[model samples]
Target: MRTVAGAPVRAGLPTPVVTYALMAINVAVFLITALQAQSVMDNGRGFVNPLSGAAVFDSDLFGRWVLSPLDVADGDWMRVLGSGFLHFGLVHLAVNMFALYILGRDTELVLGRSRYVCVYLISLLGGSASVMAFENGGFTAGASGAIFGIMGAQAVILLKLRRSPAPVIGVIAINVIISVTVPGISLFGHMGGLVAGAAAAAALLYAPQWLGAGQDRAKAVRIGWIGLAVVAIVTLGLIAVRAAQLRSEYGL
Candidate 1:
């Protein structure tokens, strides 16, 4: 692809192809679901609206998984992760996918593919967990939470390198402003993802290491693994707490 400002794009950078693919998937899923919504409503067949606040925890596609909004309030717990993958409208999906493209490519370049994926998933989950914590009865759907997490990760990495984080901080601040000024945006989810991303990035990029002078490269790898572990534990803890809450509510 062509780079902006007439510069050639480097071929060796971590391209974030997976990130792009994820965006595509989210868009596609939203489109298909939207169409489905239209079809059902148009048919007037007395079909219950899946988008209804009541359908969330209902079993679907083999009754094995709970969906969002409904499950979020019903305390299905799993919906915290599942909800991140759903979107309410075209603009919602587009904004998130764009953010992912812009921030994800650079994060992948800095952290490599595996670590990049780890950060994204953790951030996504973190955002969802935040939503569950703060909002209990609304139908919330979007990728902003995960995208914020990625931004947080980028900021953490830049800070560790002693690079100026002014630009990034500015971007984050602007986004936060937009989120708050605009109606229907989940400020809680976005802030949650941002905090989670920062924590994960700090563990990954700045934890103390014990490598000798000649073993800097190896030390970096070790630190990354440790950071990943920390992030995983924290993320799982959040999910578990949400799950427990759900179970208690449902008496399951």
Candidate 2:
């Protein structure tokens, strides 16, 4: 299987431990969503409301957890990060988890732990920013944005190494097509992730070389930490600024 292909380690390299852990966490979160959904459906206080047609998660715990643009504008900025881990439903969770496992495993190994984590957070925030800017509405959650970023990062490094990016580009193209054609899909989020992932990976791959520390694992780790900090700061700033604008314009 393609997923299995991404799992094996080579030349005594470390296993993709973080990748596996992330997959597990995603699954665990999905289980929570599922149970919550079931409770909502069972209780008379909830279900798909006839008026709004939105499922009421009993106490609305799950609903509150979504990346609500209005709520975000009110300073619930944590949703930008939290929403990446939340899925709307079972199918949504399954597909994203599958993609995460496949792409994350390989990317994690190639980038190593520190760099991989940095790329992921940056990409996730990128996607969140795009959604906040454009999608502007109820909660949108999924790991597709981050997964797309991983692919973009991989492509950037491969190109830098003079490797063929045809397969990677092909996959990205297909996904982009789907994002545009499919209903209820976040086109901006995917594109945001693509750009962010590529940018972060480029920094990781080239920054060290520029510093004359090419291939130095320790130096790479240091750069990864610094890069992550920079990305986090920039992301938070964007979210804060955009959220204020949204609040003012929309009166949230």
Candidate 3:
């Protein structure tokens, strides 16, 4: 039987619980934020009706949950994770949730639920770390970082299967360009997620080769965790270093 990362390719695999759960949570969070902000179609310029283009109230979620360098430096650490779930507006949330739905399914299929979650969370933190490092001031929020990571994982998995990763690479390139050119997009967050996702996926997919162990499921899982742990540690360290710099610079 053909296998992916030593996991047998079988029919009737379980549902992608993590992916759906994430989507639901994101939607729930957006509803709460939108209700509080008194607007469902919030945007950078302000909220608006997508159909009639009528102006609406501004979103308040960013104020509370966005990852701000100064706020992080002042020890608002939860923002690092919270920001990943926060979105600027309806369009932002819809785009990210769509990407997550598309990428999350295949990734969960290949990496399994647990490993996929590892890659997602680490990539999110990596994105937040990048924002802290480079974005001096202002707010950053959304799951684009995590979505980019999922895209990265798809690319890596294709390569591991000895297939051309041209498709995903093209997708990534287009998105990268958009990030660079778009006014409100977070380029650092996307790039950081891509790097972290690729690293984590590589660890999980290539764990057997690196560990010099046969394609045993148990051993592969263990080594994959080790790889993820390493990535997590590196991400946390970067966050710490950047936070310290901001604190010292701001005298916070």
Per-residue alpha-carbon lDDT of candidate 3 for residues 1-252, written as tens digits (9 for 90 to 100): 434754445578768889999999888888878887777776322444799753343555555566877878888898899889988779889999999998898888787777788899999998998888888766788999999999998998999899999999999999999998989888998998889889888887886677886757677767878888998999999999998988898899
User: Judged by TM-score, which candidate is best?
Assistant: 3
Task: Go through the candidates in order and give each one's C-alpha lDDT.
Answer: 0.66, 0.75, 0.83
Task: Report the number of the highest-lDDT candidate.
Answer: 3
Give per-residue lDDT, candidate 2, residue 26: 72
Which of candidates 1 and 2 reaches a greater lDDT?
A: 2
Order the numbered candidates by lDDT, best leading: 3, 2, 1
| Candidate 1 similarity to native, TM-score | 0.78
Q: List the residue pairs that clash in candidate 2.
A: none
Query: What are the per-residue Cα lDDT tens digits for candidate 1 across 141-231?
Result: 5678888888898888887777888898999999999989999788988998898887777777666342332336556667667777888
Misplaced by over 4 Å in model 3 are 1-3, 6-13, 43-61
lDDT of 2: 0.75
TM-score of 2: 0.83
Q: In candidate 2, what are the lDDT values of residues 1-252, reduced to their tens digit?
A: 111112224566567878888788777766676676664222213356799865565534456666767778987777788778777666777788888888897788777776688789889888988888888865577788899999998897688668999999999999999999998889988887887888788776666566676656677656655665776677667778889999999777
Off by over 4 Å in 2: 1-13, 39-59, 211-224
| lDDT pick, better of 2 and 3 | 3
Query: TM-scores across all candidates?
Result: 0.78, 0.83, 0.89
